[model samples]
Target: MNAERLVRRMIDVGALRFGDFLLSSGKRSRVYVDVKLASTFPDILEMIADGIAEKLSGVEFDRVACVELGGVAIAVATSLKLKKPLVIFRKEEKSYGVGGDRIGEIRKGERVVVVEDVITTGRSALSAARRVEKSGGVVGAIIAVVDREESGREFMSLLKLSDLIKAYDSFDTTKS
Candidate 1:
């Protein structure tokens, strides 16, 4: 599907909305994508997974990763569909034992495909990728449901890794 139409359907499913909203990373936005809604619906969930899968058909990568909390579900779903390992990155060190930034299976030098539900400021995915690198993994690319165009992609590229932001269906990120 075209990016515009796919994004519109996301909005129709209540996954996208417009407002002056406070984001998880404490930024304000005219729109928000409640990415959790994507995974909850099997139909849309498959669409999302297939969407990313289509994007990765030839790109060389091994594992899929999601930022903690919101992203883990979609990451797992994508991994299942693609039949690959799904890794996870934690927002903060677990207060319990270990206190590690990574919570799932990731090996050093392994190629990683990072996944997220949405990107507003985009700092969260960056943090997760850094942690993944520190753990010896190479973050090959990043993916997400909504790209609010709020500095996330630039930040992702700044990290020197491949990046793909499925921009929110409502707006045009291609425009200046």
Candidate 2:
């Protein structure tokens, strides 16, 4: 799916909002992209998966890893599309259940690609990558549905949805 189409669809589904908002990074912003809203619609979720899978077409990865909370659905869809295993990393290791920071199986030395919904500081994504590395998995890349045009480009390689954000901004301006 093209960025323009995805942007318009996100707007229609109320996934993209404008106004003052506090971000997870403790910053204020005029625009907020709540990709979690898209999870309610299977079609949109599939579209997102398709878009991400297309972007990763030539990339080599043994597994798709997602940071907990936001990245789960998209990662699941992408994993299904690419026919790869899905690995989930939580913010912290759980004391109960499997009793680890990760869910699902990831073999040591396996190449992994991380998926995220929106990236502002890239802290969480980087942290997740570190966790994967600690688990002996190689982090190949980090992909996000939206990048807030903030910091975090220095250390990590990020594939972002710039065209989609541009389309959304243009659409918002026209509406205003």
CA lDDT of each prediction against the hidden true structure: 0.70, 0.81
- TM-score, cand. 2 vs. native: 0.89
TM-score for candidate 1, residues paired by index: 0.79
Q: Cα lDDT of model 2 overall? A: 0.81
Taking the tens digit of each residue's C-alpha lDDT, what string does model 2 give over 48-159?
8888888788889999999889999989998999999999988878999659878897889999999988888888888889888988999988888777768648432222
Worst 10 residues of 1 by lDDT: 156-165
lDDT (0-100) at residue 34 of candidate 1?
78
For every model shown, what is its TM-score relative to the native structure? 0.79, 0.89
Residue pairs clashing, model 1 = 7-169
RMSD of each: 6.0, 2.5
